[model samples]
Target: MQESQSLLATARSKLEKSLLAKGLRRSGERFAILEEVYSRNDHFDAEELFQAMHQRSYPVSRATVYNTLDVLVDCGLVRRHHFGEEDNSKSRYEKSLGRQQHAHLVCTVCHRVKEFCDPRLHLIQTNVGNALQFEVESHSLVFYGQCTDDACETKPTDSSANTEDSRKTQE
Candidate 1:
């Protein structure tokens, strides 16, 4: 999306091929939207993405954005989340599916977001599935805490209060 346009070409080819196989129209803007999302490092909501794309004159519509996102979800290319009831029907989208253990930290005070990766999630999923004899489909874990300007340290048996204090300084 940023450079040699080949990235866009490859992504478009894959998306179009996938969509065509399902007998769906490969409407023009969806590929652009997917390329933008895949090439970026930030999480986004529909309106946020639409505004940003419109500012860049990407020829995108809100409906197409949402539709493309649904397609991405179906294709296992993106994950969606509902952060709040007041989110105006816009869901947060993140980039990932496999080999990724993700957790989020939220500030109810300011609604700030933070993400982390933990490898132990796979083991947890496996154990949970084994315990229930139900195959683990997918899982999400989010931890909420009040974040202070200076340092806020809270751990969940996770007796890393001191370690957390050190990490907060980086923020």
Candidate 2:
């Protein structure tokens, strides 16, 4: 609990600094959105966040949510991900402060996202950068397939459905 509180304080301070630097208003609604975001561990879209704000009785507008998300992304307070081609219109976001760089495992059938970090991935990045004499600042790697969890949604068994799903996943 103490660690979580400390993290939130640091995040809040960063957001304040960013808002000031960008000449954006220091609104309580933005802070409330930050708090709501830091309170969650899942990857979520903007609509889900707006619903959560309303569920918590905050009642922020959809535009506010979207704009705040843009601010957060620009200020490095959040990380946005484009998981698949099928849902290119919807982007998922996660809090980035006090967190290490990680990769994602996405379930195509259930559309669930899981995060993982592998030291070897970092090593490989370093090795490839050295080999090609190129600077590797960062990377985004996602593995998409069916999840094994019992709660994961099952894929349609029909041949046409399978073909369509496979095509989407490959994109």
**Best-performing candidate as measured by lDDT:** 2
Computed on alpha carbons, the lDDT of every model, listed in order, comes to 0.73, 0.92
Q: Ten-residue segment with the worst summed lDDT in candidate 1?
A: 149-158
lDDT of 1 by residue, 140-165 (tens): 88777666644333322335666788
Estimate the TM-score for candidate 2.
Answer: 0.87
lDDT of model number 1:
0.73
Error of 1 at 108 (Å): 1.2
Candidate 1 residue runs with Cα over 4 Å from true position: 1-14, 97-99, 149-171
Which stretch of 10 consecutive residues in model 2 shows the poorest summed lDDT? 149-158
Q: lDDT by residue for model 2 over 1-171, one digit each (tens)?
A: 898789899999999999999999999999999999999989999999999999999989999999999999998889999998486888999999888889999988879899999999999999999999999987899999987787655745568788999999999
What TM-score would you give candidate 1 relative to the actual structure?
A: 0.73
For model 2, the stretches where C-alpha displacement exceeds 4 angstroms are 154-171
